[model samples]
Target: MALRTEELMLNMGPQHPSTHGVLRLVVTLDGENIIEVQPDIGYLHSSVEKMMEHRTYFQNVSLTDRGMDYLIALQNEEVYCLAVERLAGIEVPERARYIRVVMNELQRIASHLVWLGTWGIDLGATTVFLWCFREREMIMDLFEQVTGGRLHHAYYRIGGVYADLPEGWAEQCQRFVDYFLPRVDEYDALLTANPIFLARTRGVGVISRRDAIAMGASGPVARASGIALDVRKEEPYEVYDRMQFDVPVQSEGDCFARYRVRLEEMRQSARIIRQALRGLPPGEIRTRVPMTMKAPRGEVYVRTESARGDLGIFLVSDGGETPYRVKIRAPSFSNLYALTEMMKGWKVADVIAILGSIDIVLSDVDR
Candidate 1:
């Protein structure tokens, strides 16, 4: 007798904690090694694009929050508002632009914190999970103080933010930024140097630069794979053109590389926040627009760098109060498509490590 072998098909989720959220992974396994991983998505679909067509442009801002990536709701609002503003030929005040940048950067940091904390839990670093949430709570407090809604803040308006920074809000934001940077180094100390973490992530889930680009990876995912592209740096929406920050890039394209890129990105987000606060301008926070405003009869597409990647909104107006057609180019959807490439040829144990590294929000994927 030479040998006996068989392949097994395993379903990882639809409810499993490691699958992140309502995702099903049909994995083909040859003993402990993975042969193929097919992701089954759409369990969380909200049909947000179709819903946007039935609501007014102003109403759609709140929809974007709950209907898509709820983690970075402000960024979602910013991109949707940008599309409407462009289509309607509205001018956002200078102060509002600066405020958008500040809020957007803070949103980026907060969203990344959620990813890091959950990922830490996935990797069995309970301390990292606790510490990450400790800091994220501070950011959440800041959001609640300013926007009045911690998670789904309808803060960004068609031409500006819903309101100006409340009293002491700027000072508090400065304090958070000052306090948050050192903590990132502490995270580095904990997970970045741990031998177990390194073993699980260092050479695992490797995706090449060419495949990353071919697969349309963006934001930190693409940057981790040596593709140095960012919508803030490339397209320069809102006041990002005025802000000073560096786009972090890594060439290794492994699970560790993805972790390193996101950690550095949190630091850069703080950097951008500090600059925005320092150069905070003064004026009206919003430009007045009619409650039932009708945009021009035309189509416009706008892209913004959300917490995940390139978030885009394609809007068509029939010179009416409601959108004629709305299409959202969600970053999580594109980033999730690259999962198949990342999970191939890894051990069965490496699946969670690779999937968590991508940071996909189920709503964003299914929207």
Candidate 2:
């Protein structure tokens, strides 16, 4: 027995540039190849899920929404309303539905902006980060104009929206989307078309459809891997049933595919918004519910196509004023689970690419 040696062990992150936000990855390496990548999370877990039980049904909406996909605030709350409404059998006005679409799509842009910025930085394109944020700020401005809050608007309420789309809102959103639509080409010019970007991302991480489903992947990661699993289309919640858009798919299942899917989805989101705005029927923004609510004695699973993927909320109400259990099937957490499988055999540089393509938020994972 001349040698009985294992591969070298090296710690990549928890504070490294590539790990992206307080993630400590224990990677076992063999030469330049990654043998195994163990992702260590919970560093940022503030017990948001646990905190939900203490708050009222209405109160918890804001709390839980922040965790589902941190980038898209209030969307989870919208899902929350959908669940409890089903349990209570409440009615939402038509105008509220229109407002939900607007907020949902605007929030999608904001969420995607964060992803684009972080993904660009992760893949060694720092300049795109600034460009992404600049566009995101415009979306934020629109949110503030209507909701009067930037980050966690709590704009969504149990029965409906907190209020109607503010005065002259249509004109504001029209200008923003019009000006913003052309900038997609600028991003394409900046990063996507560059040969270096293509080389780094083109075929970096390939996840097959079967493996992606078996591994419990969702969102762009699964879709990019050739899985046609979109919560919006499969299960129509909100106005997605009437909306006109296509679920972008790619067979490559690589980092480039994920990048392409997100870019294309941005266009789809804009399209959905335009349709929602044009055909936006007028009605009440919210349904009237008391500060505290007692849902019927039943269990409901409400899922929506969040910016990430399937944001499922499994809420069991024991006919109480608050939910007995609120289990969030966050897409980021699900998507992140497949990272280890993809990371193996990839180089250190490729780790960032794979992680970027996976597109996860620590909040979603820890919650």
Candidate 3:
């Protein structure tokens, strides 16, 4: 007797919810196990780098806000501003630096909350989605109070931020920090040890330490694989060096490990924000700079710890009103490639679980 088993091919998304944006995956399956996974991206491609070259240093702040990683608009603005500030030899005031750290940490929490909520939905925990958003809304309200715009806040400038915190803003932020810490505990109670979540995430989509480094995985994704590569700790910017926090790392390198890393990161972010509030110096919010800013004729590369991962901006200045060239080193783009390695040997159903664990935004990948 002889038997023949044929391999099958399937397309997961160009419009699927789990893909997180217009991402398509071509999966080759041997019965229930995936033999290969090819991620099809670029559906949401927009030439953000090209746009940066056309816009002035100030104008590009807004452009960076919307163009790359919409969720992490502040981080985008920070990296861009850092590059220009370095080239121009502008020093951010001590108060502004602390405020920047506070806002950046708040932005990190907000972005992680979005990831947690959507990741819960992807994993079929609808209640978690609701709770996570509840926390996120509070952070958004705080942001709106300071910047006027919640998500696309062009508050960061070439020299410093646009303005100072409003009256009672510090007290309100401290209150939010106090309120938000307990909620993190609630999430742990809900899913950290739940059998179903454990069954789905643990031991699934495992990435080896060797593969993680070689593939250029950063942030929690690489940290989960036992790689201690955090931009904040490795290379501190703003007041991060002054602030105290730990980079959470897990050696499991699976979906569960990634989940643990981010959950711990939220707590650490809160700690940083609290510290920034306490030590925030009182001074001018911004340095005096002309509306049309120009940088020295040179190239600079600035990196920051974005919510997604290591977000770097390479800027070339020709001593002109606009940048000569701009290249964005988006974290999601390289992390997307690592998906293929994670998906191999897992079932189709595991695809959603693994993809959610990575917490990728297609806009970051396509940009």
Candidate 4:
């Protein structure tokens, strides 16, 4: 008889704590090494994509926001505006663009902080997790001031934002950025220098530049691999061209490099927010929208540099009041594709650290 393949199988999640949400992974292991890993998503499926067809332009704003209930309003409204803006061929007002950039960058920083904190907890570094979340709360407070709700603001609409910046918003944003800037270095001193973190992450879950590109990775994952592919830098959407900031790239595409990339990105985001505020002009937040919204009988795609990665909305209109087809190419779904390759030859415990570093949000994966 032929020699045995010597395979062992384990279910890592669907109920595992580190999954971060409803995600399941069927991993095939050769002894202690992972040979194959398949992500079984949609356990939290809400089918938001299919539902977008029924709602009108304004009424559908709330649907897209529902994808990552964690990013709440900023996640949905921002992408939807890009979709609708491309459809209507409208030029958003400068003030609205400024405010949108400010809020969205803040949200990106907050989102990364949550990732940092939670990743630490999964790796047994509990203190960093708590400290990071504490800082993230400060940014969330800023979101509440302008958007009213902390989670889903639905504040961004087509052509412009829902309304002007709330009173003292600029001053408050300036204060937040100033207060937040030093904390980036604080995190560096806390985690970057810690030997335990360095050992666990320095060379683990390594991916090459060619491998990352072939795997369709984006955001920090692709950046860490020295690809330097950032939608913000590449596309320059929503006044990104007007702002000056460097995109951090690491030649080492290991887990540690991914950590450093996001940390550096937060500092850049803070810088962008400050400059946008400096250029903040006085104008209408929302351009005049018609009662019956209709896109031309053509198709267009708009992409944005979301905190996760490249978030794209492909919109198809048949000269109708609502989108005929809307396809959301969620980055997490693509980013998670490399997990099998990354997990091979690693221990089971290291899987959490690896997955968390990729920062795959389940909603983004499922939808």
Candidate 5:
């Protein structure tokens, strides 16, 4: 008699740890091999876009922090402020621009640390989780020193920042940068040469360059697939055009490639921060604006390279204090769209490894 076969349906979760933040994966399995994966999202939706319409431009900064990708809250603030500044024809001061760059890069490194550490836990490499947070805590201290809020710092203002760098903040940041680079190598030593990690990540969860672009994947996900596009390099917002850094790219497009891209990106973020610190200009950190500032009657769209990917905001203003319509092109949402493409054809055991590689934040997805 011929062999008998059947496909099984498994709900991976709106609660499972590997699903990474309230994502539900309706997974189809033929034995241990995955036949199809359909992602069910929106369990964490907060209607933040709608909320922006009722909040003033200034109040929306804080909303962006909690409502979007909270990992890199400063970047979220930067993009939102940039939109409001453009719409209202406000020019940010020179010193403020450099400070934004510095904080933005620092936040990028911090956010990637969170992703790396959590991903390590997902893959059973608990040491990486411990070591990554060890460094991230230092960055958090730096943030707390300046912004007074470690997690949700609404530091970026419409024209610049909420305050100037506190006393010794620059020196402290320099110390952290000097200290953090060597620690990255330690992480490499642990995972880069590990046989088990290599077996699980290498040649797994591969996505082609064409598919990555077609699905609107950005940041490390797209760059890992050999798409050499970064908004910092392409659009040149703030002081990024003047900064010297490399946009790391890999052709493998596998989980290992994603890991390598993010690792190198952390190094590059440090590079940008060093340059921003070295070229720190002297001027006001924030430009004075009315508490109830109203933008002109027009619409503006702004894009910033967030820790996750290409974060964009479209603001429609009717010469009012609050935005008439707000639409956020969250990078996590786009990157998550590519997850289904990445998970198919992999073994059931490789699901967590693959899901962890994309690094999705549900807040960004559901916002």
Candidate 6:
């Protein structure tokens, strides 16, 4: 006897918990096997670029916090400020530069913790969600002490950071870093060797190195697929060139590989922060930049290694206080497109595992 199977079209979400945000997935399935994946975006679109053009250079920094990936708001501010600084030919103080590196790396850890917690929840590892956030709270507390805003810090300014690091802040940060290093190992103990996690993530939704590069995946996703494209190492922005760290890579390009890449990144980020804190200089945290400053008539594009991956900003100044055009090269936007390629030919249940692994933020994608 012979039996025929027909494809079933299923809509995973505009509201599903695993979609991460307001993203909808139109998936084709033959029984439990996935035939194709079409990611439906634009649900969170707010024309962030157009909005940036209307606001002053200073105002746009705050706008970036709200519009882009809120989870990594400091990185968003860092890229914007970096572009503006280049256009205006501003020089950041040595101390401010080191502080920026330290703050940005801490922000990376916080953002990754959020991803780990939420991803764990998606994979039904409820305990990991709680454990990841517990350390993340300490990171947030450190940020609050410095920037006064836990989520949307807007701590970075045009020339440098908003203010100098408070007294003993470095020591406090060091204490937290020392405490947090072991917590990462605890997370590995909880998830990496767990039989259930390996079953759910290993060999599911594989994206080969060629496809990863061809489709523009980055950060942990592309690195997991065996691509060594990292803006921090290749471009060497800020104090990254001085800091000693490694770019973790895996050839598997599956859900578990992505998981491993991020887990390793947390350790590297902690290492970078420790180094920055150890060598932190004493000086002014910010350079003198007027609030109503006008950038020279020029166009500049700057790229930085954000938590997700290579985040870039293209700024065009008409010799005015406000920008003429601002285009944000969001890593999540490009990373989201790779989902279709990765999700193809996988089972329906593996969808959550794969999507969570990619770590796309809809606001960053849709902005």
Model 1, position 306: C-alpha lDDT score: 92
Q: Return the top candidate by lDDT.
A: 5
State the lDDT at 234 in candidate 2.
93
Q: Report lDDT per candidate.
A: 0.92, 0.84, 0.91, 0.84, 0.94, 0.92
TM-score of each: 0.99, 0.96, 0.99, 0.96, 0.99, 0.98
Please write out the lDDT profile of model 6 over residues 291-362, one tens digit for every residue: 999999999999999999989999999999899999999999889899999888888999999899999899
lDDT of 5 by residue, 112-227 (tens): 99999999899899999999999999999999999999999989999999999998899999999999999999999999999999999999999999999999999999999999
Q: Higher TM-score: candidate 1 or 4?
A: 1
**Candidate 3 global TM-score:** 0.99
Give RMSD (Å) of candidate 5 vs. truth: 0.8
Count of clashes, each model: 0, 1, 0, 2, 0, 0
lDDT of 3 at 344: 96
Per residue, candidate 3 scores C-alpha lDDT tens digits across 1-367 of: 6668899999988999888889999999988899999999989888888988898888999988888999988888899899899888999988889988999989999999999889899888999999999999998999999999999999998788998999999999999999999999999999998999999999999999999989988888999999988999988999899888999999999999999999999999999999999998888989988889778799988999998889999999999999999999999888888889999999989999999899898888888
Off by over 4 Å in 5: none
**Per-prediction CA RMSD (Å):** 0.9, 1.8, 0.9, 2.0, 0.8, 0.9
What's the CA error at residue 228 for candidate 4, in Å?
0.7
Writing each residue's lDDT as its tens digit, candidate 4 over 94-158 gives 88888888888998998899899999998889888888988888887888887776777778887
* Candidate 2 ranges beyond 4 A from true positions: 1-6
Question: Which ranges of candidate 3 are over 4 A from the true structure?
Answer: none
Off by over 4 Å in 6: none
Model 5, C-alpha of 236: deviation from truth (Å): 0.7
